[model samples]
Target: MMHNVSHVRFFFLSGFNETVNFKVALFSLTFMSYCVVVLVNVALIVIIILDKNMHEPMYILLCTFCMNGLYGTTSFYPKMLWDLLSPIHVISYSECIVQALVMYSFACCDLSILSVMAYDRYVAICRPLKYHSIMSKQRVLLLACFSWLTPFSISAINIILTSRLKLCSPYIDRLFCMNWVIVKLACFPTETIVNNIVSYVTIIIYLFHGLFIVWSYMYVIKTCVNSLENRAKFMQTCVPHLTSLLIFLITALFSVFNTLFGSTLPPTIQNVIAIELLIISPMMNPLVYGFKLTLIRNRILGGITLQMK
Candidate 1:
């Protein structure tokens, strides 16, 4: 018998059961990792904001990217750290929904921002004379808003639809709440038809976001091939964006495939796959950009030298 949706007050997270013996070690490592993530992302954001020269379109988009990384990781790490210490691994229904909203929106916004970054680069290299006019501060602001709001709205709709279902169980088998996992807990298959439809539509929409990035890069690379100047520009600006995109795609795809098909895998391996995006992408993106971008690297090293003096 399916339970009443109104009575579903909390969810038991079953992923932590196996970690009870090593929770302390896990907590210390996780806490340290979260600290490093925050430190590096914030350092980049601060570098971008403090230097007037860093206020260009590429840096602004990078700041937004790091901000999004912080936002995404914040949703996962605090609760995870708390759960590591607490014996009962449960979350209130409303809290679970909120977590799902932030987590999915964060992921979607990542792809959207990356797409915008690709467009920004394309305009910079392929259409050099029109670059400033096209990627003006006002236009970039508009694009940034679109990147964030569109994904949040789409994620919110999915979460709202999932929230309507009468769930058959309150046990979430993973470490964190996910929109699809919640939908899967619905009492009736017929009730989830709309949910499945909307889910596919949302996936298709982001699939296009991925395609747009590819299209933008194709034009970018072709333009960069002939001119030494454009190739230099590409090495300086576009490489970091490409690296970040590759990291995001790899980690995001791992999580997606693991979610869809890793049921038979060992729980430890499954857990690693699920959290890969959260841990690897968030931590690596800032480091990749910080070290790769010349201006940012000089500013950081200059500051370090000044402090050492």
Candidate 2:
């Protein structure tokens, strides 16, 4: 079979074919959801920035986490909303690669940020005296930059490798572009060997990130178990982090499973799974933190009450 690597400029997203009958409804819902996501995340970010009392390391991490959610969701929602209303669903190859980069980086950065948060909790509970010195503003800023730059560099490498493949098909079966899906379109399996290696290596690197988070929490829990004050601290600060981690892991696992076994499921179900991370994690993280953390909760409530006055 002859492959036309040079001429493949755009990829057709066939996932929209099933939505023609309800495009308008889908468009409205997607647009509104995107708006809500933006509003909530931005609200949290603003609250944290304006209130100097909330400028501590933990709150700074939370703000970065919300900003990441916004970054991840923005890459998908706008494209999706437009595709929902358009008759033809297509994305240029370059645009698809960029989307995949941003989406994957966003996810990887989420885990990295969570790892940093766990460390912050660990230091706060385990070594309270050194918490300030350890997580100083400069150190937190460095960790935050690491959380973002590391994942983006990794995802950029993946996208670059993916772009080198000679694609046999231009039709992507899903609603959005994904690195693995694009790699599967390669004309020859032998060419994807390097891609596969790098992909697994990336997975292992993040898997260790997951293990690190688990270890930090375990240590924190063990320490908190022996002390009443530590337990209270755990309840107030660590609980929200744990909730966010749980939400991220669930959505991430769904996405992975959908990628591996999705063809066996109905299209609608597959679509839902594909989008679960984008919708649920981004929207729920801020809500969980806003309500669970007393300081943030009081701040939000105080503002609401002032408006009522």
Candidate 3:
């Protein structure tokens, strides 16, 4: 009889190895953060769904964005909370891959959704006469689906390629499973050429997303410069979107650059950078949108007051 064994069936996450002394504190903070993330995101999602006035393209896109934030954070925080409680910090191979998929898809989809939001704002501010026709509910739904499905498909391809490699090590130095980190574990460096190509391509694709956002904002800024009404609209609406985008890109690029170059930093700092996107974006998106967009804010206040009554 012949036996076929897996090369690596699990990965040991070393991100928290040195920080175990603060496990209780870390768990407390993470759990509280996770609760806030869920509550805020879900609240926004529900408010958008229930309010007919907010059924516009911008709010709908914001709703999808929050949903994606929730999706991504759920993938990390639960397992992370568990690992924080456990002495052994390990993840099964399949679970790791799925986590990587969820994370990448969530992030890429976020950029995609943001791009759509940028377009929505551009149309509203720049081409108001055609905004309704261009961003109809059907069109909005299509764009939202495209934003989500395209990233998921891209991430699935990357994970599929990763699954075929024969891993040289079972240890991951980070707090969670990232696709690039998994690629680095391949037994032979030559085997990862395709993965690298795919990753760069993915990066370039999202880089264009960033460019779209920049170009959109440039035109928006230029348009708002001369008109007081446009300026008020910009401050009232577009600022939140831009803030979310800024936070997202900064945290995401920090992680990517740190992973590729920040070898000299302590593991604690690296861990902080690695999880910054998950921590900051999920919490910030809803708060920014919830407070900045008045309709949703009033709806929430109304709901709370009714509850109090």
Q: The CA-based lDDT of model 3 is what?
A: 0.91
Q: Which pairs clash (backbone N, Cα, C closer than 3 Å) in model 2?
A: none
| CA shift of 190, model 2, Å | 0.6
Choose 2 or 3, whichever is better by lDDT: 2
Candidate 2, 256-288: lDDT as tens digits: 999889999998888888888999999999999
Error of 3 at 58 (Å): 0.7
What's the lDDT for candidate 2?
0.92
Off by over 4 Å in 3: 1-6
RMSD of 2: 1.9
TM agreement with the true structure for every prediction: 0.97, 0.97, 0.96
lDDT of 1 by residue, 1-309 (tens): 344354678999999987899999999999999999999999999999999998999999999999999999999999999999999999999999999999999999999999999999999999999989999999999999999999999999999988888987889988999998898888889989998899899999999999999999999999989999999999988998999999989988888888789898898888888888899988999998889888999988999999999
Cα error, residue 167 of model 1, in Å, equals 0.8
